[model samples]
Target: MARLREEAERVQAALGAAEVQLERLGQARETVTEVLAEPDAATTGQARPR
Candidate 1:
């Protein structure tokens, strides 16, 4: 019974980590989307000497 409980805990931990990773990826996608939607003049590279 103890071993089963330990396994269940490990599975739960794995699932939690996966969910966090998914959330981070989602946020990254939204950030990229926002950047892509903006004008070139509004971007970080707008002031480059080139």
Candidate 2:
């Protein structure tokens, strides 16, 4: 019984860590998507040619 409880606790801790990592990855993906969706100065014809 004690061993089972310890195993469950360990598994829960690992799951929590994995969830945090997944959330960070999701946020990073959203930031990248937003950046890519925005037009740069060149694409918007706002850049001066050298």
Per lDDT, the best of the predicted structures is 2
lDDT of 2 by residue, 1-50 (tens): 99999999999999999999999999999989987887787778886444
Writing each residue's lDDT as its tens digit, candidate 1 over 1-50 gives: 99999999999999999999999999999989986787776455575244
The residue pairs that clash in candidate 2, if any, are none
Report how far off residue 41 is in candidate 1 (Å). Answer: 2.3
Worst 10 residues of 2 by lDDT: 41-50
The per-residue C-alpha lDDT of model 2 at residue 34 equals 82
The TM-score that candidate 1 achieves is: 0.80
After TM-score superposition, what is the CA distance of residue 31 in candidate 2 from its true location, in Å? 0.2
For all predicted structures, in order, the TM-scores are 0.80, 0.77
Q: CA lDDT, every prediction?
A: 0.88, 0.91
